[model samples]
Target: MAKIAINGLGRIGRSILRLLTTTEAGEGFEIVALNDIARPELCAYLLKHDSVFGLFPKAVSHDDSGLTIDGTRYPLTDNPDLSQIDLSGVDLVLECTGKSNSREFATRGLRAGASRVLISGPCPTADQTVVLGANDEMLGDQQVISCASCTTNALAPLARAIDTAFGLVSAHMTTIHCYTGSQPTVDAPRGDLVRSRAAALSMVPTTTSAGRLTDLVLPDLAGRIFATSVRVPTASVSAIDMSFQAQSAVSEKQINKMLAALPAPIFGTTTEPLVSSDLRGRPESIVMALPETHVTKSATMARVFGWYDNEWGFSNRMIDLARRMTSM
Candidate 1:
């Protein structure tokens, strides 16, 4: 069994803990410790009652000593500076603290004796950025590996499929993402002008690094893709709108067939006109919305839609990547 530690108890972090304790994916891995900024009580409360995912089994609880779930207790180190934490016996540290997507932060885990550090989002300084089906083959013995952002996870596979069938000329993606911890429920002052507005009552547009990160993982698609983001009022799940020009003729039937044939854990396709709420807890990277997929008369250009439970899917991928790294 591999020993693991998680930093941060936010949406992604809690989701990771939730899966590790309640699902089969949690097997064969032991959570040695956890580091976060919240008080032990607050973290436990959030874990037990997640507004988006609903209450976890009553078994989830915590105290000043640490968090307890699924018959295991993990020591909690409530600090933002990871360098001060004691990570003895930890084989991997799943760094979900969005703030630690850097080389310096990754090194902290390694220096503290972790065999590897798996970050939740992409980091240019990390040794490798594994996007599962897209470039998991490139995973190496790097001390630091990134499980690229939720958007990148959802986009890379589609980009690969489109590029394989019809050469990608250029692409633009707009992610209709849900409000996150970074955004406030009511209008509040923030350094970033757009994010300062109320997240629950507005459709706020913001920038996304997913396109740039996607290019890093799939070098062939570099400079050919761009992305924008819009933060919606919803609390969970997200929709991605993609428009692209391909070198070959396109047809709905062909595109549908292509997405339909994608392997498990990567994508799933459906013709139903489903709402974002319908995918609240799915673990697939993306679920192609066949009914919304459109193609130009000439088939050289097309539009595609995909929906995902960003928090749950991304957290699941983090565990999968961590396990793969330990196996390697």
Candidate 2:
């Protein structure tokens, strides 16, 4: 079995762990190590409190050194330093830390003998930004990969579907994302240069790396996409409101049919109203299209809505991508 390492046991990391535990033995890869800068107790608390998958596998056990799951015991590394871990047997590493998106971390994992690194969040220099249903074929085994943001994964396939059916001229999106670990429950001093003055009390207008990374994943739509984000008070899940200018006339029915025709394993479509809460544990759906609301007032303009379990959905993709990379 191939060995895997996860960095940053936060929202996405914990969710990924849950996915690995629930998947069938062969489909689920082995977790060799989990690292976080915070105390080990935090990771323990998360594993114990997981609502969707419940507790981790009984075969799994952890101590101060590390935890063992499915006959694989991953020792806990003292620090988040990538170079410190014994990567001699690690086949892949998943970096979920929302820290600066740098290739250096992934590079370190590779140098430590890891076959490949899959970054959960946006990286400053990602060789490829993959949206599972949209452009997973773009992933190559020779380089490190970034899964982009959860919102991007939700929006990319929708955008690509429209662009493929009827050429996309320009697109804009406003992602109503849930509050993350990076945000404080109460107002506190911000750290990064751009987010320093922002507050959690109100929706803050912030740029999203999604649109920029989306272009990389689907280069055909490059320069035609832009996005902004507003952090809401929710704990998990997020919504995306997207508008596109099509090159030709297209009705809601036409777009709905296209989305409905998508394979079940990758895309999900529903006639009933879809809410963020409804998508909580839906692992296979990278994007859910709201058929009722999709519309086009003119030959060039169309609108769509999508909901995503940002952590679970994106983490599942990261795991799948990691497995594919290992197979090569």
Candidate 3:
């Protein structure tokens, strides 16, 4: 089995470990080490009990030495600098620290002896930004790979499907995302003006990179996509409302058919109507909102809806990509 290490223990990082220790999806890999600014005990405590995912089903305990789960006690290093951490025997490092999305910081993992470094969010310096169903096939020999943001993953399959059936002309996305850790619980002074307001009490509109990242992932659609986000009070799941102009005529039936036909583990389809809450723990990258999909007059305008458990779904893909990187 390939040995892996994880850096950062935030929402995504914690979710990654929760899955690795509690599910079979973690097979073929072993978590040898973890690095974060938090204390080991805090990391261990948070891992066992999460507000969104609830308590992990497995036993987790920690001390100053390290974290123990599933009969293994992996070493924990409390440092931000990658150079100080011991990564001996680690084949891959999941860089969950959002700060390492740049090429220079991402390359530090490689210099530290990791065969591959998988970043959790968008990485401009990455050798490739991979969205599972859209372009993971391009992961070739890349030492640094980005699993793009949750919004990017949720939008990629739709872009690919639309481009495949009806040539896409221009696209826009309005994501109704849940509040994140960065937002203040109550009104507080901050660099970003809108984000300083209470997180749970307001629907704060903000900028997003999904549209631009989509262009990067699908060069054919470059300069044709735009996106924005609104952070709501909800705790977990996020919804994507996409409207795009297409070159050819299309129908709701065609969109449904395309979504239903998407490969497993990447896209999931359901005829039963679903709310954002229903997708809280879903593992797929994107789940089609079958009943809400629609097309405009002349079939030139199309609207699609997708729901994703931003934390878990993206973590699932991260786990899958980490395993793939190990093989290379």
Which candidate achieves the best lDDT against the true structure?
1
Question: On a 0 to 1 TM-score scale, where does candidate 3 land against the true structure?
Answer: 0.97
State residue 137's C-alpha deviation in candidate 3, in Å. 2.8
lDDT of 1 by residue, 41-129 (tens): 99988899889999897486788869888667889978777778778678899988887656787778887777889999877788888
**Candidate 2 per-residue lDDT over residues 149-261, each given as its tens digit:** 88888878878888888888998898988777666656567765434433446666667878887887788889898899987756667778888888888888788778778
Number of backbone collisions per candidate: 1, 2, 0
Model 2 score (lDDT): 0.74
Tens digits of lDDT, candidate 3, 1-328: 9999988899999999888888898888888888889998889888888888898887888878689896789888887788677676779999998887567898877777788899999888998999887887788888888888998998987788888878888888899999998899999987889989999999999988898888888887888888999999999999889999988888899878878888878888777877888899999988888998888876889898888899999999999888788887
In terms of lDDT, the poorest run of 10 residues in model 1 is: 99-108
Q: What RMSD, rounded to one decimal, does every model reach?
A: 1.3, 2.8, 1.3
| Candidate 3, position 242, lDDT | 92
Best of the two (1, 2) by lDDT = 1
Shift in Å, residue 194, candidate 1: 1.5
Q: CA lDDT of each candidate?
A: 0.88, 0.74, 0.87
